[model samples]
Target: MLLHYLKSSLDDIDHLIDLTKKDIEDIKEANHELVFERTKIKNDLVKAFENKKSLLDNELIKMVSNNKGMDLESILNEEQKTLLNEMKIKLTELKSVNKQYAKFVVIVSEFYNTLLDKIFPRELEGYKKANRTPATLLKVRA
Candidate 1:
């Protein structure tokens, strides 16, 4: 049960990391609709990952209870330990990639906000940011 959960949890995280990389590319290409479309998938993956992690944790706790005094690392066999180490490394990579993606998103958002501000020229009232109205498209017949 322990090894099964361990492997499954690892797989879940790997999928999330893959999705994150793909999302970064989608953003770079300004395929925002695709990015938004993937959000539900990403969220589902995250929920599944969390569930696997919770199951893994329960299994680990049960092992500790059965053996008494032994910590998680001590109880894990070589294979389990290896899988845990791989998860740690992958998690680090995930954090790095997520941070990079976050920065890119902030830059894109700021660019759009600045452009809107220039176009709309918001009032300088006592608000932190300006309120924006919807932009309209003009269609003319030839």
Candidate 2:
């Protein structure tokens, strides 16, 4: 039962990581649809894992603590250990990919801001009225 829950959680993380990778690709391609899809996937992933922390912290902890001084590795089966390790690796990859995506987003935002500034001119001097001299003929008529 514990292994089952752990595996399920790992699968969720894998799916999230896959979606994040697709998000990066979609960003590069400027695909709005795929980006929206990735957002939905991210929300679903968050909902799925929202309530599982207690199970991991309480139930899994109790189970793993039963083997005298033995750690989780000594208690878990070979397949379970392998799955846990794989989850860790996938998590690390996800972190790195997220960082790259964030950097790309920041660069794009800065480029957009610079473009807008050049076109719209943010400084007050750009909007100031031109100075002009009054005609002298109007004074003679008065």
Candidate 3:
């Protein structure tokens, strides 16, 4: 019964790891969205001009153009920009957190495997040691 309870506990931990992995995936997706939003905002900041049009397709620029909101600026105000910039920074931080979460998931998975290995080392070793098993002969006297 104690062994069964321990196994159940490990299964619960595995489930927690699964849930944490999902959260990590969600953080990554949110980070991608934030990056895209930042790019779009920066592009809008510059796309209204002639020579600045080249920056739109580069996919590498980081700064919003100096052109402050004269006409198109009404679409997003200073407060909105500030909020988005803050969110972008937060998303970046979350990405770093997601990296740590990934490492934690790997450690948890490895720990479970180690525990299972300890419980069945011989069977595991046998599978690793040989691809084929030698046949055993039996002698019989009648």
Candidate 4:
């Protein structure tokens, strides 16, 4: 029973990691819709994982503690330990990917702001006429 729960939790983490990778791809493509979809999927997965964690902590952990006369570490067999370790590694990778995605977003935002500033100077008002000649017009010969 405890092993089953641990395996399920590991599977959930693997799925989450997969979704995060997809999210990174969406970010690279600048696909806002896909990113939003990925975010929703991730949020739902998180809620499911929370429920699973509650069950593990409240039921599986207690059962293992009572039967094995030891904590979770002592109860887990070699395979379960390996799965747990793999889950930890995947989680670390996910963290790194998320950090990279955040940095990409910030860089994109800065670029957009810079472009906006160049397009609409702060000194120019909506009613004010620009004194400078247009670049496109200057290129045309009379």
Candidate 5:
């Protein structure tokens, strides 16, 4: 009976290890998606800026040809202005979401490290000892 219980415990540990591996993989995938989304959002912002600049240049050229002396800012159509504002808002949102994703990744990484330490304690201990040395106290005599 005792032997059966020990076997079951080992099996449970194995299952937990597998689950932890899957969780780590999922976190990595989420991190990649966040990076990709951020890049895409940045690219979209650049494109929007270029479009806005082009519109302003065209308006300036039109004003110069017409001899009206109009400013570029006053020439933006309502729809174009709204689109630019929407893109800016989306860019800010993407940045915020990416920051949250980074925080989640850190949490997942910490959990993964904890699991690794439990599964391979000797290696984890060695790494911890090498990286986290105790601070020495210096005695100063005046």
Candidate 6:
């Protein structure tokens, strides 16, 4: 069961990496359909990965409770240890990819906001602005 959980988690990370890269490509190409489709799959994989990680953690805790003296390294076999290492590496890669995706999203948001501001200037709208209060509780006479 331990090995199964580790392998399944690793597999999820692999699929996530692929899906993330594909989404980046789709975003670059302006393929909305593929991007949305892959986003759903990626979200499902993320949930599965979280579930497998939780299962693995529970099993490890059980093992520790059962065997008071032994540590995790001693409890896991060589294969499980290798899979855990691989999982760590793949998770770092996934983090990097996710960072890229986040940066892209920010850029796109800024571009749209700038475009809207140019096309329809807020000053010309002649509408009363809301939320005029300061963010903090301090009162200023200026």
Per-residue lDDT for 124 in model 4? Answer: 57
Using TM-score as the measure, which candidate wins? 1
lDDT of each: 0.83, 0.72, 0.44, 0.74, 0.51, 0.84
* TM, every model: 0.87, 0.71, 0.35, 0.67, 0.39, 0.82
lDDT of 3 at 140: 41
The sequence of per-residue lDDT tens digits that candidate 6 reaches over residues 1-142 is 9888998898899999988888888878877689888877888899999999999999989988888999988988899889989999999999999999888778777988777655544443257643333334344578
Give the residue spans of candidate 3 off by over 4 A.
Answer: 1-74, 122-142
For candidate 2, write residues 1-142 as lDDT tens digits: 6666667778787787788878888878878577876787799886775455456557657867777687877787887778767767977887898898888778777988777655554544467733333434334553
Model 4 segments more than 4 A misplaced: 67-71, 116-142
**Model 5: colliding residue pairs:** none
Which residue pairs in candidate 1 have backbone atoms (N, alpha carbon, C) closer than 3 angstroms, thus clashing?
none
Question: What would the C-alpha RMSD of candidate 2 be, to one decimal place?
Answer: 9.6
Superposition error at 2 for model 4 (Å): 2.2
Order by TM-score, highest first: 1, 6, 2, 4, 5, 3
Query: Cα deviation of 45 in candidate 1 (Å)?
Result: 0.6
Question: What are the clash counts of all predictions, listed in order?
Answer: 0, 0, 0, 0, 0, 0
Q: Given candidate 4, what's the lDDT at residue 91?
A: 72
After superposition, candidate 2 runs with Cα above 4 Å error: 124-142
Residue 118 of model 5: what lDDT?
A: 55
For residue 121, model 5's alpha carbon misses the true position, in angstroms, by: 3.9
Better of 3 and 5 by lDDT: 5
lDDT of 3 by residue, 45-77 (tens): 333322322332231122223334443334445
Score candidate 1 by TM-score against the native: 0.87
- Between candidates 2 and 3, the TM-score winner: 2
Cα lDDT tens digits, model 1, 1-142, are 8788778878878888888888899999999898888889989988988898899889888888998987877888899899989989988998998898898899999999898776665665675655654443323457
1-142 in candidate 5: lDDT tens per residue? 2223233333433343343344345566765554444455545544654564555556547655665566545655565455545545644654565566567678877988877655544324644643432223333457
